[model samples]
Target: MEVTTLTRVYRYDGIDLPVPPHLAGDPSALRAYHATLYPAILNAEAVDLGVSNGALVTEYRRAVGTKGR
Candidate 1:
C-alpha cells in the first residue's frame, strides 16, 4: 500500500487558519478555489509588501478601465 500526505498553508494576522473539512477531503474543490482566489490573495500580499494602498487602488482602477475598452 502507498500512503501520501497533503499539506495546506494559510496565514492570517501572522497566524494560521485551521484546515476545513472540505479542503481536507476534496482535493479538487480545494484546488479550484485556490486557483480562483490566488490572484486576489497575491495582490493583497503585494500591497502588504510595501506597496501603498493608494497606489494599489490606482493600479486596479487603471486595469479596470483598460479592460472596459
Candidate 2:
C-alpha cells in the first residue's frame, strides 16, 4: 500500500481561502457566472470581507465625496 498527500493554497486580500474540489479544477463556468452577475458578486464579496452592504454604500459615498473635494 502507498499513500500520497497534496496541498493547495488560495489567497484573497493576503488571506487564504478554501477551495472546493470542483472549483479547484476548472473555473471557466464560475468566471462566466461572476462576469454575468458582477454587481451581486461585489456585494457578496464585500460582505464576506466583513463589510456590510450599508458599510459598502457608505464607503462608496465617502470615496465619491473625496473625489469631488
Q: Cα lDDT of all candidates, in order?
A: 0.38, 0.36
- lDDT by residue (1-69, candidate 1, tens digit) is 975453544443443334477675574454445436344432233112222422211111111223333
Candidate 1, run of 10 with poorest lDDT? 55-64
Name the 10 consecutive residues with the lowest summed lDDT in model 2.
Answer: 56-65
Per-candidate TM equals: 0.27, 0.30
**Which portions of model 1 show Cα errors greater than 4 Å?**
1-4, 24-43, 46-69
The TM-score that candidate 2 achieves is 0.30
Off by over 4 Å in 2: 1-5, 27-69
In angstroms, the error of model 2 at 54 is 40
Residue-level lDDT of model 2, residues 2-66, one tens digit each, is 75443444333344444467765554444334435343333333222233333211111111123
